[model samples]
Target: MGIVVNQSIKNTFITFVGFAIGAMNTLFMYTHFLGEDYYGLTAFLLSSANIMMPLMAFGIQNTLVRFYAEHQTEEEKSRFLNLMLVLPLLLVVPIFIGLALFYNETAELLSQENPIIFDYVWMIPVIGLFMGYFEIFYAWVKVHLKSVFGNFVKEVLLRIFISIFLLAVHLNWLTSIQFVYSLVFIYFAMMLVMAFVAFKVRKPEFHLQFPKDKKEVLLYSAFIIFSSGIAVLLLDIDKFMIGQYIPIKEAAYYSVAIFIALTISVPMRAMHQITHPITTDLMARKKHEELNQLYKKTAITLQVVGGFIMLGILTNIHQVYALLPEKYSGGISVVFLISFSKFFDLMLGNNNSIIFNSKYYRTVLLLGLCLVVVTVGLNMVFIPSFGIEGAAIATLISIGLYSIAKLMFVVFKMKLFPFTRKTIISLLLIALTFVVFYFWNFPFHPIMNILLKSVLLAVWYWFLNYRLAISEDINAVVKKGLKFNTPR
Candidate 1:
């Protein structure tokens, strides 16, 4: 818990800083500098690349985290790491060949609605290749329990680079096409930096010999490829599909709402950086009790923190939209729907790490595949009718059903549940706070209104949570921060 809290706090802070920079780029710079059409194209390309990333990396990122602890000796560890590095090429080489062979057809298919996408379709695989290896190296550091630097590189440095590139575009130093092409270079550079940091953490010895458990390792990696792809698909497919089904600029609109909603998941993302490795270690050691305890603690902590973020976003959603251009304001409903879904995901805490590391991972993978089909179908049915809001509806339904299924699977199979009486109390507190402050807005600028409401919400929310002791971990941190002793 000490290491978990320490790193999570640092990671959360880093993630918030990253999000702050990202918000400026998404809300202001991209909107003002890139315009809606190009912004949507940028969003589409990235989302498409993300959907391709897992396949290109061949699931080595997740495999490393899950299997690295099983090796008992340095020789075995080196062999395992070597295999992780080499396995991705098994798929990457063939995928590249296929992309080259079918480049015209592939580009044509993607650019059916928007010919602008045809020229940029090549960037998807290039960026996805970079993204794949980046995660592989990022996972390399995570297995060593040195996630902070890698996270900084991931969450902070990448966005900062994007900001610089966008600023360059603003200055007429780079055309919109050049700015799009720069994504490939940016991701490739970041991947190399992550690789360097990973090797410095623990340089792997070169070896051709595979681990003794090569069969299980390959099997796990294979399942993980689809499972990881399925997960990524659930997240980014909506944006990609939006580009296909509607005007590409709608993807930009959806991206804005999604970014705002994405803030609610920051704590979970930060905590997962450390908890994933810890959860993998616990499962490897078969420490059920500790695992269950971790499951609950992480759940409550994230719920409390994420709930606050969601409240801030939802209560002040109109103000947020007010700051954006009138063309982008239609996504207010998208923000609410996606924010609710993201908050639900955060409340599950380390559920993903727990399930992915468990033996029943294959079952979950199959379930995820099914949900992917459903998500696609829903998008097909809804997008033409409801536009970006329809995409949000599809996402909300898919994620809600998916989250509930994962929670049930963990509860039934592992005899573990993350919810408690405190969970209900946290919900009540969130609802109460939202009701009290949501309708009451300051008669001031949008920025000032947001600040005033956020401060009031924080004080009221945290005070009750600390007083009621909803989470011992959170209460301890609050006490430590304030340097005060309070009766439990």
Candidate 2:
């Protein structure tokens, strides 16, 4: 628990800094440097690659984390790690070759609405391969309890490179289409540096060692590939769909809404990097009680913090959007829908990392596969009618369903739920607080309105916990900040 919290705190700091840079790059700079269609294309192309990237890697990264932790001998772990790295190359090479065989048509279809896509589609799988291998190599370091570097590389370094790339584009060193291609290369470079840093810390010997029983590796790796592919596809399929069915500009607009919506998931992202390896180790030890406690506390903490952020975004979204150009204004509702979906997701805590690392993981992933299919179908049906907003609705429905399903699975299968009477109370307070602010309709400047609303919201949410003597964690934080427990 201590390690998870400590890592999460560090990751939280890193994510916030990156998020600020990302917001500037996406909302302000992208708009200033590029037009609506080109900016939209910028977002759409990357989203498209993200959706397909998982397939290219075939889920071995996650498999590496799960299996690498199980091995006892250095020889055994090294052998498995070597196989994991090589296996993805074998899987992706064939895929790239196959895609290349039909390159002209694939490019044409991918860029059907936007001619720029035909030129840039080739870069998608290349980015995916680097990202995929990066995760696998990163997992090697993570299982060793050195995740700060990987998180920094991912959340911080990636953004830093993209910012520089955008600045280059802004200065007229690269055209729009060429700038998009450079993104793929930049991600590759980041991963190359990430792999180097991870190896420096790990210093694992470079030798290709495979287990005596190769079938076992193949089976586990194959299952994870399908499972991980479906999960990534579910999260990212809409960007490709928007580009395929609608226009690139609309895909771009929808991407902005998703960026806003996904901010609520930052804590979860921070937590997941720390939590997954811990969960695997704990599961190995059969430490059910500690795991349950960690799970429950994490759920509550994420809900409480994520709920606050969700509300903050909701309450001030109108003002926030006012700062952006008019093309992005329509995405306000998209942001709201996406925020609720992520809020529901946050409410479930670290249910995802738990399920992913568990023994019965395949069943859960099978359920996830069904979800991707249903989500993609929903987007197909809804996008033509409602455009990107429809895509948001599809995401909302799918994420809501997926969160509920996973929650139910854990509750029924594990006989555990991350809920208490305090959870119920906190939710009631959140609802009541929203209604109060919704009606207040304050007469003030935009900045003042935000300040007043934030104060009231924070008070409403925290007052009950303080009055009821719950939230020992909150009390501890306050005391630590005040140095209230000095040895006098």
Candidate 3:
């Protein structure tokens, strides 16, 4: 808990800073500088790359975290790490070959709706390959329990670069197309920086031998590839499909709304950076009791924190939209729908790490694959009718069903549940705070209105959570902030 709290706080702060920069890029720079068409194209390319990333890395990132704690001897560890380094080539080499053979065909298929995408099609795999290895090395550091540096590089570095590049586009120093191409270079830079940091943490020993559990290791890695692919697919598929089904600009609009909604997941994302490795270690040691306790703590803490973020967004959603271009304001509903789904995911805390590292991971993979099919079908049925909002509907439904299924699986198989009385109380508090604030607004500028409303909401939300002691971890932080000591 100490390490989790320490790192999660730092990670959360760093992630929020990154999101702040990203918000400016998505909301203002991309909208104004790149215009809708190019913005959408940029979103589509990145989402497509994200969907391909899990496959390119061959799930070695997840495999490393899950298996790293099992090796006791340095030689054994070296063998396993060396295997992790090499295994991705099995998939990477073949994919590159296939891309080479069918580049034009692939480009044509993706660009049929909008020819602009054809030129950028090659960037998808290039960026995905960089992103895949970035995660692989990022996981390399996480296994050593040094996640902050990696998190900074992951969350902050690229967005900062994008901000500069977007500004360059505005200044006419770089064309919109050039700005798009810069994504490949920035991602490559991130991968290289992370690799350097990872080696600094612990330089890998080159070994020819494989771990004795090579069979189990290979099997787990195979399953993880599908599991990770399915998960990424659920997240990025909507933006990808939006480009295919509608004018590419709608992907840009959807991307902005999604970016706003994604803020709700920041706490979970930050916490997961450290919690994942810890969860993996616990599972490897078969420490069920500690695992369950960690599960509950992480669940409530994230719920409390994420609930506040969602409340802020939903209540100020209109004002937030007011700040965006009029053409982009249609995504207000998109923000609400996606934010709710992300909140549900936050409630499950470290559920993903727990399930992915467990024996029943194969079953979960099958479940995820089924959900992926459903998500695609729903998008097909809905996106044409509802537009970007339709894609949000598809995502909301798919993620809701998926989160529920994963929660049930963990409860039934592990007898571990993340919810408690506090969970119910937290939900009620969120609803209450939202009702009190949503209809109320300040008679001021949009920015001022958002600030005033957010302050009031934070005070109301955090004060009660503290009063009721919804989470000891959160309460301790509050107490520390005020420099108060707990009674003996």
TM-score of each model, paired residue for residue: 0.90, 0.89, 0.90
lDDT of 3 by residue, 1-488 (tens): 67766877788788888888888888999999999999999999999999999888988998998899999998998899899988889988998899899999999999998999988898998999999999999999988878888888877888888999999999999999888899999999999999998888878899767889988988988888887889899999999999888999999889999999999988888888678879988999999999999999999999999999999999999999898889999899999999999999999999999998888988888988999999999999999999999999999999999999999999999999998999999999999999999999989999999999999988888989999999989999888977765554
lDDT of each: 0.92, 0.79, 0.91
Which residue runs of candidate 2 sit more than 4 Å off their true CA positions?
1-9, 69-81, 202-209, 273-294, 439-452, 468-470, 479-488
List residue ranges in candidate 3 displaced over 4 A.
1-9, 66-83, 199-216, 274-294, 483-488
Report the CA-based lDDT of candidate 2 relative to the real structure.
Answer: 0.79
The candidate, 1 or 2, that scores higher on lDDT is 1
Report the error of model 1 at residue 431, Å.
Answer: 2.3
Instruction: Tell how far residue 152 is off in model 1, in angstroms.
Output: 1.9
- lDDT score for residue 114 of model 1: 91
For model 1, give the 10-residue run with minimal summed lDDT.
479-488
- For model 2, residues 152-210, the per-residue Cα lDDT tens digits are 88878888888887788789998776777788788888778878976786666557558
Ranking by TM-score: 1, 3, 2
Best by TM-score: 1
Q: Model 2 — TM-score against the truth?
A: 0.89
